[model samples]
Target: MTSPAVPRQPLLDDAIIALHAPTQAWSGRDGDIGDAAIDGIYHGDIRHIRSVRIRVADSSIETISRSIIDAATVEFGSVLRGLDDDGADPKVRLIRHRALSAGVMTEHLGLHSHRDVPLSVAVTVEVAPEFAPMQDVKAGLAATEPWHAEAIAASDGTPGRIEVRSSDGHRSFVVEAAGAAATVADTIVLRWDIELDPRSVVEIGWSATLTDDTLVVAAAANSEIAVPSTDDPRLARWVEQATRDLAALRLVLPDHPEDAFYAAGAPWFFTLFGRDSLWAARLALATDPGIAASTLRVLARLQGTKTDPATAEQPGKILHELRSAPLSLPNEGVHLPPLYYGTVDATPLWVCLLADARDAGMPEAEVRELVPALRAALTWITDFGSGTGSGFLDYVDETGHGLANQGWKDSGDSIQWRDGRLAEGPIALCEVQAYAYEAAVRGAQLLDDLGEGGGDELREWAAVLRDRFRDAFWVTTPEGRYPAIALDAHGAAVDSLTSNIGHLIGTGILDANEERACADLLLGASMSSGFGIRTLSLGAAGFWPLSYHGGSVWAHDTAVAVHGMLRSGLLAEAREVAGQLVDAAEGFAYRMPELHSGDSHDAVPFPTPYPASCRPQAWSAAAAIVCAEAYAAAP
Candidate 1:
């Protein structure tokens, strides 16, 4: 006897096809099933179009092929059947071309009649605008609530034009149509009548423009950068995909229109993230130094000015995440203001980026101007970061609503001991200390070379911190001696062999012998899955292939480790890791996702994808660039 068969979910249902230009981005499902239920056109963190569907004579079209023409344009080929006058299967091909430019989207549709008889078809487009905040949309709460705006048909307008306005009259979207017999059937639908002769074609166009009551239009600027080429075909394709993904992720600030920085990722994290953007810009230094400069300036402008427990803001601290709307979860007692500053590592990472930008040959005057901000960041590291006077950087969420784990692995269960027990805060992460040390040493050099003083003070602090870290974090296990993941609240080493130690490479926090030991351990069978290094070793009690931070392989993390190995003169090890990353990229179509399962390479022919991983993530894209640059520079 056979059991009940479960319905197979459509892979394209959750697949993302996106196009963006500066502050404007449109993300949707691919193929003829482009449902706007969860997909929409977003302008500066606001959703404009919730649902858009095209039908011919009340018959839905089925997609045949789809392609991304460039960073800003997408083309889709679809066909409608059974629309003939004789009720026979029809051959009507529809070509849809969409492009985004300067906060406006233009869509062109081509309808061709392949049959011998003349065809008269009634085309209809249904659209709905939610005016929902991006955060609400990301949380999947927008569709359950009624739309915030009402669609108003434009009067005294040419042909087909409709406008939608919020109740407070603060935001509006204007949509215009051309080259077809069009009419506004109702508030949310438009009709176009097309007459095509035998073997004839007709084309129609539509444009949607978003406007605020303040009339603020973001200045348009291009973010395309040159990507390095390599002899390996797989590496070349990965670099090309990385370059395009980074270009599409660029977000221009409304106030500083001339400057551009990459948003974190698409779908959920398409906003300014302090740590994510800094790391991406740093990795892309070989490609474009301008990204590092612009990202540093933007983050400096938003640095914390005062202490506020409710939003986790503290003086001289960098922001963790920024949202366009206030986030409140009453049941969970969580309320995150738009500009929250709860990150423990971003402040130190900011100083490191400033120094990296200077090293990349930024103007001396510009680098000098940021010296004060760098000093303030260093001061935060000393005064606020080391709360226990232990000379180690640590963080604890003061507000019950803020994040529990404040490091890169911000999930609640991310920080744990070897016995699968959760560690107590204020937790000092192993990577955070390494980042702080690198920031200090590099920042001290910038201060001395840029005509600023007090380099010795930061150097002294870094020396002490490094000595303390080496003494407290290193542990001897039966298998081998490895660095602890972090220190718990009671000052006990939270000994778990994880990928966090991989970040210590190239940071100067590890000595030559220690670096070699880490490289060996990272490449060992318990830690490496042949695709990439796992977050946690397989022998650990908390190891699970699908766990977000425990056993998953993050593209960016692996890239960082490989770069460190290269810096440590472990060329063979670096190449081995890079080969696995390239193999994983092949499974992802050369567009790496945020992470994948840490399943053994021999267990499956292809890398297993994490269910909710964000594709085209900023740092993940930069990982490809980092690996390509490393290989090109290798002997």
Candidate 2:
């Protein structure tokens, strides 16, 4: 069999126009013409507008500078130059300001003339709507089918307003221009003519509104939650960026318009995710428990109700992810059904999030109402999660097309033995057991506090599981004793030293001595990249600094380890790791991506950006928040 191809970097430049608000977002390179390969406006997982190009006198303009003002605003400055009558340079500068909110994008363009003569310029904005699925767009594929567009006749006898309707009639948007001579030149082009005298400027305003009532209503009701500030400037900036990014990522579910939960990430995974949302919400609990509350409620409502192998759904199991459109990778034979429940950890993580939210001051009445869901989730852990009577939370892909490794490290090659061979079916990940143990203990406490019985049974189960995990998973390496990454189908320990053991800390699955050993290993050279903890150790057989999950340093993973260490009383180690994360965030302009290269910090002064890593990732953004909270609470 052919070896799997390594992931490739995006062809688009890093400098791009990206503005997002929950379910709607637009990302494209900073060019006069939008590249169909990587530029589009997406809504509900569908690409509504594929290409947007701005032309002046039939020539594409070159960008001089670009700046992102906030989550919703970006500004680009470009210049159009042509020889004057004297054959000298006559620079014509164009300033484009774009803002997004409520699924609407408004652009303001200003033309400035530098020469001492009047210049008449004909500017046109070309747009195309593909209505393509977001999955294909992210994969850098062109639209497979054509989407027809028809210009809407100007209403109120005004030519400044232009609207386009999709062929299917399910989607439509309007573009309006003001303070310039504007008209529809073609089915997909809007033209503006303006005359600017020497040293004078003429400005035009353009607005594109996606006619979605649900998005409009949600935007109006959404309010920003304030993140606490600290004396440390770096930490403060990290917190601010994380807070803004989280707010931008918040999407209002169609069923629950009043409440909001964060979509997974931008460019891809921008939808309700069972594990990612639960973890992001949990990390932000100290700032606002409402996020966790809403996320739990939404996931509870969507919990699996029956056995469906195609989508990997099982009764009482939390969903892995939900997408509005079915995704089929081109020629890859991998088709993702709308709903997936192959995750073994999300159910326990859901219970843990409930407990964390309650501790973070979620209202009692709301907590009480979720008791039934909590019980159902616990039942899932006891029944389906402990596959084959292994006394451990494990997972095996029921469908051949489903994810092979269903933990947070869901990539196919993520779970491997020390000798670099892939682990087989019914694999038991170490962190999944930690999550299960934590869920049981925390769930028992929540139940007892709420005057509900059955706490004793859960506590006993947790105790037994913890002891069994310690006996079965722990293995001594050359460096020290740490939990194996996972157990293979043959019940042999997959002895790859990885960041998975760090997750066991503070989860109550490991004893004090074991937690200390794990902490030491985390801070040691094998695991620590001086930027963040690598997913796998450097000495491991399959270690690849740039690999997606094999050795890349994930911000959220580092944050989790830091938080765990802090809770386990490893103050020095916690501070060191947290400080490294803050430094890495600075290297990424305070907007940390999903993961970065695991190159040694001494070898590379800055965190290496993982090609195609999601920026403003839900968990990555929340990592700063989690670290900030830990710093503030440190004694």
In candidate 2, how many Å is residue 2 off? 20
Best by the TM-score measure: 2
lDDT of 1: 0.78
- Model 1 clashing residue pairs (backbone): none
Q: lDDT tens string, model 1, 436-515?
A: 99988998898889778888999999999999999999998754898899999999999889999889998899998999
The C-alpha stretches of model 1 lying farther than 4 A from their native spots are 1-13, 21-37, 58-60, 83-90, 144-157, 179-187, 212-220, 329-334
Cα RMSD to the true fold for all candidates: 3.9, 3.2
